[model samples]
Target: MTRRTTLNLPQLRAFLAVVDAGGFSAAAAELGMSQSAVSHAVASLERELAAPLLIRAHPVRTTVLGERVLPHARMALSAVRSVEQLAAEATGTMTGTVRLAATPTVCQGLVPGLLRHWREDQPLVTVRVFEGDSSEVSAWLEDGTADAAVLIDPPPATAGSYPHPGVQLATDGYRALLPRDHPLAEEPAIDLRDLEDDPFLISPNGCEARVRTIHRLAGLRFSPTHRVRDLATLISMVQAGIGVTVLSEVSRSLIPADLVLLPLKPDTSRRLVLTGPQNRLWHPALRTLADSAAGHLAHTASCTAGPAVGQPLPSRSG
Candidate 1:
């Protein structure tokens, strides 16, 4: 007979928390438990499985076996939550928490507006936002840390296409960000070659891939004087006349008043879509949020400052 040992939810939670928070102390703070308790829980789990899960070091990371186990843990937890949500639905009270993930720009630019809309439309549902880089955001959705997420440029139909149902929230193109008094700022549209002489900055937070492609298509070297991770830092550097960068037009709201954003000579656009989980059943609130998003876009279509959702644009790389 095979040995049977029941897995504990708290232990699994402790393990996941440590990995996500980056350390035992941080995980303890996040889970409202002592550091020793968190560590003990993980140790108990490791002993039960007869395998080590994490490397004990600064900013602790998962071992190879832990990586294989994490997705199963996430799915198990999500399934439990779904059962609880079903019970609540039977009571006629439509209320639950949703974890939504997004890149830094989407969190700052689009999430606030969606949350505002949800407040009025689905008052009982609470949304928690997890801000991460694009890759992290995608992984979170797949692993159930995020019930839904905003994906950039998801493929239409292929093996690599998004696996879940999604709705396109907005379609916007890239624009060059420059100081208001800069020489190129006077022009209606700036060509990539014209700015080659100036110091160019690239934000690797999520936009670097598209920026590299833009340079390659323009037949120019993709060298940047600086590679910054924080959008605010990049904006500050550009505002101080240190350099210039390109960003999505959706982020116009976050731009300072002294900066001017102009379209490129040849437009490059990307689609932003809100999608549910890929490997787990959708949380009840996930569908509600998607519906609310669709309604919000339809109502705001007439007066939205950015490009309309799903509108066609010029042929260019996303």
Candidate 2:
């Protein structure tokens, strides 16, 4: 009798977890397994396949075989989730882990509140957030690493693309950040061109393109004195009077008391939306989250105290 080669979800998940987390130890921690157990799983998988999948190193690197196997592993896992989702849908109880991707800003500014609502609305659903730049978030969605994502100013779907439209979560215009003592800090609102003479600090954190567009619209060059990657670093540079910068008004919550946030004249804004996979059927929890977000935003819109989605920002003193 010939022996049958076998693969199981645990083995596949172990392989993927090591590749994604960059090491067996980290992957074990993520999966709540012992490091040796995770290693054993991968080794067993390699034995079953009769090939090496990963190079053992400080940070594990996938062998060619592993690279080839990754997509199939992801697909297998995604299919299992789909089956679970379908069952949950039929039973009228949403339950599963949703891998949600978001840009750093959205993760910091918006996701906590959104997660709170999800926790209450669907108690059985668990959301695991992956925070990255816009490009990384989009790529994760494409590769099936994430079931849903919070997209920033995503372009309109072309013909024959994903049928379900993205649900808008929030809209926020750009605001200029300056040292309290800067010359333009006292103005109610400053024109974009007015800051052309000063050194500009910008973060390439998923908003650089929009900032360039705003500069182009204002008839100024989009050159930056420094391109900072971290939001905290960018805010620090402005606070130290190194340069001024613009950020989404949603970032107001993250700004310190010392940095002055002023409105920009001839304003440009970005729309944040909850979106799901374009090529595959969405996990039912994702659709529920989108609907819940729409209703939550609508409810928030009626309240007077805070900013609302799709509305002009409330005025603030300089």
Candidate 3:
């Protein structure tokens, strides 16, 4: 007696077509084969598996056995397509998710607008945002939880410190946020000395280190009337006449209707940086997000605080 051979590619392909097309005739049309040929393939597949692979009703449907095999078949097809894509992308193609971390301020002010613009340009890439303080963001990068981060205060400038292999991105300086009615509002820019005696609002502990540095540099101390965790809340306090706060120009939009933003005096600035691991593969989505963030930061410098005020302030970046 001759032994029957295992299922062949043609049989599997035809079965898949029938399952997708919902009928043998339709599958035959799609596969450019005769209906009988298509049916023969399905029969062969079923015989090899020793189980019915389809239920023949008015509209044919997959049997339990067919359903079980369908997923594996689909996954196999997907893997083939992915391999082809990778081959095509050998020259260059950006796809997949880019996990990004940022302080609350960067997340609220920079990321939203940037993502809006980036979606139009690179629709294939998805950017997942993680919000935390600078320290937390650093930790996330170190732990492989995020692909990159928008850091406000990077590590100190020393060998193996600033611009570490773990961080590869641009940086920017800080700006000042004040009430529109405040005295400093009239100046095109003001120095830290200009803010003397003003009621100050500071961010939470880890993230506030930069604010502390700013004060220390100017040889002044601000008794913050309010300490908040998020940029929106901190800006709210500034709007309520609670006090003034210094923030990145990227977060200038967070100012309330009652507030205004001014460039810092003597040009004290925080580094707005994009950082990612040295060994991590670069995703097109992440590059788009970072570029969008940079562009939005430029436009946001002139933004006036609008109705977004009094809303629950967004989270802050570390």
The top-ranked prediction according to lDDT is 2
Is candidate 1 or 3 superior in TM-score?
1
Best-to-worst TM-score order: 2, 1, 3
> What is candidate 3's CA lDDT for residue 32?
77
Candidate 1 per-residue lDDT over residues 230-251, each given as its tens digit: 9999999999999998899888
lDDT of each structure? 0.82, 0.84, 0.66
Quick one: ranking by lDDT, best first? 2, 1, 3
Off by over 4 Å in 2: 1-3, 158-163, 304-307, 310-318
Clashing pairs in 2: none
Model 2 Cα lDDT, one tens digit per residue, 1-318 = 977899899999899889877899888987889999999999999999999999999799989999999999988887887788678878898876678999888898889988999899878888989999989999989887788998887776545544566677787789999999998889999899999898999888658988899999998988899999999999999999999999988788888888888999669888887888776767767777777777777777888576666432221232
Over the stretch 117-212, how does candidate 3's per-residue lDDT look in tens digits?
Answer: 667766776777788877888777664556678765455333432123222222445778888888778898889887888877888743476677
Number of clashes in every candidate structure?
0, 0, 12
TM-scores of the models, in the order given:
0.78, 0.89, 0.56
RMSD of each: 5.0, 5.5, 14.0
Q: Cα lDDT for residue 62, model 1? A: 89
